[model samples]
Target: MGSVLVIGSFNVDHVWTSDRLPRPGETLSGRYSSGPGGKGFNQAVAARRAGAATRFVCALGGDGGGDLARALAADDGIDLRELRSEAPTGTAGIYLDEAGGNSIVIGAGANADLSAAFVTAQAGAFAEAAVVLTQLESPAAAVLEGLRRARAAGAVALLNPAPANAAVAADLLAATDILTPNETEFTGLLARSTGTRVADDAIAATPDDRLHDWCRALLPHGIVVITLGGAGCFVSHADDARRGEEAACYRLPAAPARVVDTTGAGDAFNGALAAGLTQAPAAPFAQHVRLATHYAALSTERAGAAAAMPSAAQLRERFGELFSAG
Candidate 1:
């Protein structure tokens, strides 16, 4: 197993808890709390906790939020040397409804200011990694550039396309080794400005129809992993060089747990998957997928994003059965 590198964003998440989500133009009072988040930070913590040598390459503003972000990274034992300081740290205003659902509005702030040069400067760090993880929080060009370098260095590149954006390049998708997206994001990426919405629950219950189509379309480019949230996830790989219909598909059920805040759950899955790949590079793909599911389930057992992440021992203790079976 080798090191894991994450290039993404860092943000301080402000969470408000309420009985129900407010409608448009509506105001509601709720309890508020602050914690460490951002897809990059959460995933780096997840990978480190899963017993991987993990480092984070991200940009932060020299503000109060940046202080907390650095402290959180230190606490998780994630290497912060590659982390850059620019504008103020980013923030997200989050609202959590009674059923554990959430709505978030992000202020990119310094996250949007991350430049291609910053990514290029960190090429040496990426070259030393066995797996490189990225997301859509940072500039698309920077993320793609990092992927290109990682590929040239013989590292497996895993990309999570989130917070739906239309600027993603097709060439970047082709360069990715693994592409993970939730049901909503999957629809948004394909529809591209059509405003089409796919209910999360519907995707989980009947993923074969809609998700299969989406996965098939991307098989020509690379592997696709569509997350169905509680119903687990779907994996698709190209069938053969001659025939596209040779695409193979599989689904894994989510590990059972007492539901809490779901922030960073997908990031947890991706990070764990990357770590599992390093630990068991020669193992069957299903084994690695199962390990990721277990890691993600343990993350939702607590509150907050980075705070809820569990160490390798905790995950093995709670989810040893699943891994043993695998």
Candidate 2:
């Protein structure tokens, strides 16, 4: 397996489960728990579980959360050599209703302190990696710096623009190999609608007559992989005949499973996609997307973000049957 490096935030998530989301100023009683989370940490866990040799480069505060972050990374066998302790670690407060929907608020504490210099200093690790994944949890400047170094090191750059921030540099995105986003994030990027429809059972809007225009808007940069939670994902590749011929599009239906939490589904999918690409670079893009979907489906079966992430053995045990049967 190729080495994968994850650069982003390490947040301790405080989760509360309630019967229903509270209305404004409404209070409700619910279950409560805390766990390791953050897009970077979740993706790193997912990649490590998918059998990728993964490393995590992030910042935590010199507090209990930082200690827990290190412990969790150690337990997952992620290389924490690049992880730093400076400010207080970041934290997230999340509320999940009975329908499995969530509302999250992040206190970017030390995560906001992640700097370009820190990322540039860790460029050597990217040199040894086949893939470097980052998200918007950290500063945009830091993310761009990481991408610059990853590209210079000849590593494939994967960016997950989460939390919907407009401060992202377009040049950095142009250097990315794969750009993964959910419905809201994708719509945020395009800035204009192609009059696309949210496909039945699809969590994201699919390209219709407006998709071509949307692709035309983004094609000059990098490949776009829009993840449709439950419904699957749609991929547009640069060299795809569909992009040139008919608008290259690939969709992977979500694997059948009971969903307990949707929180980190996108992270799981991105991690699985990165790991799959590393393991099977020659596999068709559609196949890679399918593997990601399988890993994501498995993730939703359990609750919590990183806690619910499956290990390599468990993932293979549950889904290996499908692979073999096929």
Best by lDDT: 1
TM-score of each predicted structure versus truth? 0.90, 0.90
Among all windows of ten consecutive residues in candidate 2, which has the lowest summed lDDT?
239-248
User: Would you list the clashing residue pairs of candidate 2?
Assistant: 61-87, 61-88, 61-89, 242-247, 242-248, 243-248
lDDT of each: 0.79, 0.78
Off by over 4 Å in 1: 82-86, 193-202, 205-210, 240-247, 321-326
lDDT of 1 by residue, 55-97 (tens): 8888888889988888888887888743455767999988997
Q: Per-residue CA lDDT of candidate 2, range 204-255, in tens?
A: 5544435434654664555777777766777776653232323455566778
Candidate 1 backbone collisions, by pair = 61-87, 61-88, 239-246
Candidate 1, residue 68: lDDT: 89
Per-model root-mean-square deviation over C-alphas = 3.2, 3.3
* Least well predicted 10-residue stretch by lDDT in candidate 1: 238-247
